[model samples]
Target: MHLILTGATGLVGSGVLHAMLTTPTVSKISILSRRPVPMAEGHAKAHVIIHKDYTNYPSELMQQLRDADGCVWAQGISQNKVGKELKRNREYIEITHTYPLLFARALAASTAPKPVTFIYVSGEGATTSPGRFTPIFGVTKGRTETDLLALSKEAGSNLRAISLRPGGVDPTHHKEIAGFYPQRTGIEGIGGLILPVLRTVYSAMVSPTRDLGRVLTELAMGDGAPLSGRGVEGEGRTVTNVGMRRLAGL
Candidate 1:
């Protein structure tokens, strides 16, 4: 199946990329990256499109997304900017608001079938209720979730949208971007003792990169066409690492 993915360079997105690549069912994986991403040779159908601006997407590729089988949208930055950082808040709003909405619109305007899905990566701390807090990370996430869900609901013709609210993706491979987040688990024995608990929880509540990718791959691979429709509104899903591996039979 042909798939499209964003944030190909971030920790979560990189893990998702690895998971999709290892899965045999995925034929082509297209990435919307700000810069060209480096991947190994013979990786399962990979395409890297260098597009710095996610807000202003190319019209031609918007049409091409119609033929895509699925999308794993892992874009957006993690933030904890508070107080004197109101500008940062504005930037967050711009990214979450314009980028996801525009991309979803582009995909919808493409061809029929709506490409089956467009999985959005969100945060676990987001509240189902509406309220804004200082350093409003959750507020941004909650708003994004609401907007995307609305977009999906209105998108007829078999379009589906799902949000993954992972607590913190423990990258077993990449280590550089770990410092980007305040809650990040970096190497050098910083968050060392936490790995075991993370490992166990990942096996249950969290969806590991490999497992989440497999689930998405399975859906994209046409494993269960009917089952893929169960989104947050339809069935509500929040994958932990443990649950991810178990579902993938790892």
Candidate 2:
């Protein structure tokens, strides 16, 4: 399958890139990033496209995306970054919400690929129902989710948009967190005791980055694999971390 990947430099995106590279079923990969992806080099099927802006894509780049079967949009900013900074909020919203929607629209318009799959990496805290009490981050992301779902429901549209609400994704170095359930003790030891306890607590809600990547890639592939039709209107489109872990066989 031909795939288009964004945010290859991020923690989860890097793992997704690794999974895609190793997966024999993937025939071609197109990476869109501001800077070239370091790991993409030397891979025959990998094409790294450098672009300063995601909002305005050149015709050539759009042409390449037109031929791809699916896209994995992992591009996003941290909640802190999106919330604390005013300038960054606007910039990030444009990048996170507007750009991906534009890309999906262009992909949907392309006729070369009959059907296109889009998997968006969203946070588990996102909620469509919001009020004065809701956090701004969740509200912003939830709005994006609503728009993407609306896009999926477009009349006779060939785009399948899936939002993945993965919880904390353990970094590569902390991958061991996913392996064991922690045992908390009341007796506090040395200064290092807090770290283990925190890891245990974190592991309960977090998933390994590798596993998240595998699930994202598998869902994007649209093989007779388990994740197909997951984004269809009636079916559950927003996948949580538990669902992601199950899909990744973790």
Instruction: Give each prediction's root-mean-square deviation over alpha carbons.
Output: 4.8, 6.5
User: Please, what is the whole-model Cα lDDT of each candidate in the order they appear?
Assistant: 0.61, 0.72
Q: Per-residue alpha-carbon lDDT of model 1 for 47-96, expressed as tens digits?
A: 88778777787777776666887787788764533234654566777775
RMSD of 1: 4.8
Clashes of 1: 13
Structure candidate 2, residue pairs in collision = none
lDDT by residue (tens digit), candidate 2, 1-250: 8998988877667778887988999999999888877778789989998878777776777877777888899887654444456533586677667888887787788733488888888876777888878776677777787888788788887788888887766553634233222222233123124444545765444657778878889879872112433322214677776677667665
Q: Candidate 1: where is the Cα deviation over 4 Å?
A: 40-44, 81-84, 113-115, 131-135, 155-158, 173-193, 200-207, 219-250
Which residue ranges in model 2 land beyond 4 Å of their true spot? 82-89, 111-113, 173-199, 202-204, 223-235
